[model samples]
Target: TSTGKESVNATLPVGLAMVRAIRAYFEETGYLIGFKPAGGISTAKASLDWLVLMKEELGRPWLEPELFRFGASSLLTDIERQLEHHLTGHYSANHRHAMA
Candidate 1:
């Protein structure tokens, strides 16, 4: 499950249910569960998906960005584009260099 809008639009309920099921299975079998929702997460909502999963399933918040990494380089591109758009009222090709 991802926090990205695409994932949310495509199958949010399924993602949430899958997380729940994984949690239940882990609890029943005494297994340590690890879930990584990586890629296509450029929006704040997308980021929140991981937090929601952690809180709902694990009963805690892991707020550290190191633990919850946005896996796609393209996501950074999207963020840069949006920021540039906000600041300049247009997208700039040079914004990519700033990220680097």
Candidate 2:
């Protein structure tokens, strides 16, 4: 690849735009349209950022799976790590929790 980066990484900014669009659509329609940012979202920090962005843009309801979903296993893995860390004051290994 000329750019030396995967195409998915290039689309990160689009995620923000997509979330904004989701917010706009919800504002216009009064019915929530779910957001699923597929591909290249394979880390916990990125997942958390997406979640925070969603919660900020669309509020708490969007945090629900019925409204939001990540297309990567590692995304949920990181979120679980964060939750475990929150509850226990220490982060756990990625392999510790079974993926849902």
Candidate 3:
């Protein structure tokens, strides 16, 4: 389902449906499925939103690194930049964080 656009709009519904089907069909709750959204998810806010979505939809267990991961270097860079801003009240230059 990699659309190369990295849109929550494109992916969220599909994820939700899969979870719904799993819950509906499985009698046991021990099965775990990892969710990783990649590509153009390049913003701190979007990453946070994805976290919230996973938390709300899939619960805290999915928040673990092994279960949930982001696959975008730009997203990592933006997250670092946001963290720096939050800590120092100053944003690093865009060039400071290089995207892979």
Candidate 4:
């Protein structure tokens, strides 16, 4: 319940609450549920923080793709750009990885 600001800070509380709920559910039932931090996750830093939070709160098992996923088109752009820079020592133009 925010003012629709698409910043990471704005999303943090929501993410935290959702993660806590999932963690509690798992602890109470022993049934792991998938979590998707969808939309508005448009930056690599945001995605990284999300992974770290998931690991910290839900443990390393949440790092698996089947357990966590980002549901944004722009996130793919950021990820591809980061991957290219990591693998090739160069960052591609943002437009090059524009979400289709």
Candidate 5:
């Protein structure tokens, strides 16, 4: 059992533990299993935070974006804006696409 705050803080550790346990179970039975965390990640920082968490806890990097996904719409817009600026050499003034 965990307090609300502890549950939040322990999410990554608990998730990694679950992944390892599942992997071990599959390995013992001569099967293969893959795990990926999904949802709620938005900003670049949030995405990077997941990577950091995975690396710190799992001791490996998930280099491919296909292996992990961020579900936030705002993140996609931010990425597009940044890419547009990079290609055009100017930041977009379109507030309609800006993140709230």
Candidate 6:
């Protein structure tokens, strides 16, 4: 977890680097580790950045939901807004995409 207060943009690199080190140390064991960066990520750009970083540092498999997840609901709302803007050419109100 990312302390739920720090940006994933700032923490993801450090986290991925640590994962790489662990993978390097356990290369012979074939250990598969999942990364769940929870909290402090609230922008569509941040979500996309996470995808890119995960793909670059952890390979394509890590992009799977089973391996990677966003921990912030607000982040999802922003993503939905971006998608709506792309598809409809207008951003919807944030309340339209409510999270439970």
- Give the higher-lDDT candidate: 4 or 5: 4
Q: Rate the local accuracy (lDDT) of all candidates.
A: 0.58, 0.74, 0.72, 0.80, 0.55, 0.76
- The best candidate by TM-score is 6
* Model 2 ranges with Cα > 4 A deviation: 1-6, 9-11, 76-100
> Sorted by TM-score, highest first, which candidate order results?
6, 4, 3, 2, 1, 5
lDDT score of residue 75 within candidate 5 = 69
* lDDT tens readout by residue for model 3, 1-100: 2555644533566667765554454447667767676675778887777788878877788799987887766787788888999999999988887663
How far residue 96's Cα lies from its native spot in candidate 4, in Å, is 2.7
Over 4 Å off, model 5? 1-32, 82-100
| Per-residue lDDT of candidate 1, residues 1-84 (tens digit) | 354446343244564676677678877997755555654555555656667766766665334553334554455666676678
Predicted candidate 6 versus true structure: per-residue lDDT over 1-100, tens digit per residue:
5657653434676767866765675576777777777776789888888788878877888889887788877787888888999999999997799851
lDDT (Cα, tens digit) per residue for candidate 5, span 1-100: 1222332432456656765675577568955444454444445666566667655644453334543444455566666666788899876754857564
Model 5 global lDDT (CA atoms, 0 to 1): 0.55
- Clashing residue pairs in candidate 4 are none
**lDDT per residue (tens digit) for residues 1-100 in model 4:** 2333455533667788888999999999999988877667778888888888889989989889899877766778888988999999999998786572
Candidate 2 per-residue lDDT, tens place, 1-100, comes to 0131456541457767887888888889897888777767766777778788888878999899998877666567777888898899999986787874
Per-model TM-score on C-alpha atoms:
0.51, 0.65, 0.74, 0.78, 0.45, 0.80
Model 4 gets an lDDT of 0.80
Clashes of 5: 0
Please give the RMSD to the true structure for each candidate, in Å: 5.4, 5.3, 3.0, 3.4, 6.0, 2.6
The residue-level lDDT of candidate 6 at 98 comes to: 81
Instruction: State how far residue 68 of model 3 sits from its true place (Å).
Output: 0.8
Structure candidate 2, residue pairs in collision: none
